[model samples]
Target: MLQCGVAIAAMLTVAPSMALASADSAMLPRNLSPWGMFTHADVVVQTVMIGLALASLATWTVWLAKTVELRQATAQARERMAALEGGASLAELARDCGEASDAVARLVQAAAHEASLPGASWDSDFKERIALRLERVEAAMARRVGQGTGILATVGAVAPFVGLFGTVWGIMNAFIGISQAHTTNLAVVAPGIAEALLATALGLVAAIPAVVIYNHLARVITGYRALLGDASAQLLLLLSRSKGRPAVAFGRAG
Candidate 1:
């Protein structure tokens, strides 16, 4: 009789907890995919994930546009540089540029404009002023070419932290679920954790490519700037050679 009473008491004490654990376990999903996990995530976590995905898309988009722009600019600059070095006159070169807004074209036009000014004699002061104009044009062109890349940098730097915030929010919800369910079973805890980790994975997916793209574009831009520098040097060379001749004489020869 005493043993029977003890057994009954133990069963009464443990039954509720076991039932709670079973209920919590039943509530967990068996198969989880990225889409399913996202759908099942807390609103905040979902938002973070969506934002990261959009950022990743934007990174690639910028990479595509900027890559094309840089390639065309570099090619045009090389062409103009070749022509400039081959003793093409400013009027001829400007005609070749022909209102096309490539960086090299802009540099040539700016230099040509400075050269065309009335009474713009070829002296130290004249060269200094032309040099200043070329510098401004180069700086402006660099800034224009680099416009959309800053967003990629920001995305690369901040995405992981945004994912971490999502993960933290998810884990907090998991703990809250544990409290409500009154259970600590692996089945109940694992699903929430997996979902939370997916956020971090998404973040890395978004960030790593952004960082790589940003670096690649930076290098390409640097190379493009070097090409511009070469073009500028070629222009200065032509100016030096024309020191004693009439500017019209140089323009007429080419």
Candidate 2:
């Protein structure tokens, strides 16, 4: 009778193991399983992710290209300006600039034009007009240097939440599956959770570089703006001195 009891107890333990194994097998996701949660994700979510990725790439590309162009342009402009400071005429400077449309050259041309104008005054109103022209030029330069950066800001601001949304949707789907299956089997939940996490990871990947690049480009642009402002001031000073006027008095009059 004791031996019979031992056999029955062993069978009881083995039976539960077998049942659990059957449940796991049934819940296991197939290798060919569909995209599951991702499949159910709204098209907007997918589009946001894709657009973020593309924007990030575009910003990086523009940053690299503009960095090279600006550096080269600044170097050339500085070289030409140094030569001009040593007494080269405006006509000479323009000729040397040739096909190069550097910012400094443009400023010089504008100044020369104003100086040559029949009724151009060096007084306060004239200076104000010159300042307006310079400001417009500065704005144009800023726009060129800052191209494609706004998208990065948008991505940085929105990607994390987009990822979270995707994750939440995926988790909700996983819970629904668990409820339908009436089992707490890991196989039923793990795949959905993994998919959800992947979206979040992708979102972060899209955001980090965009944020970094945007900051870097912003610094470069700020430096450029300061440099242009200084150059514009120097040009005005040159005009004042050439007209046999004191710098402070001329500036105040303008």
Query: Which model scores highest in lDDT?
Result: 1
Tell me the tens digit of each residue's lDDT in model 1 across 28-64: 8766888888888899999999999999999999999
* Per-residue accuracy of model 2 over 80-133 as CA lDDT, tens digit each: 557557665544554555555677766766655555566555576666666677
Which TM-score value belongs to model 2? 0.74
TM-score of each: 0.89, 0.74
Model 2, CA-based lDDT? 0.66
- What lDDT does each candidate get? 0.84, 0.66
Candidate 1 — which pairs collide? none
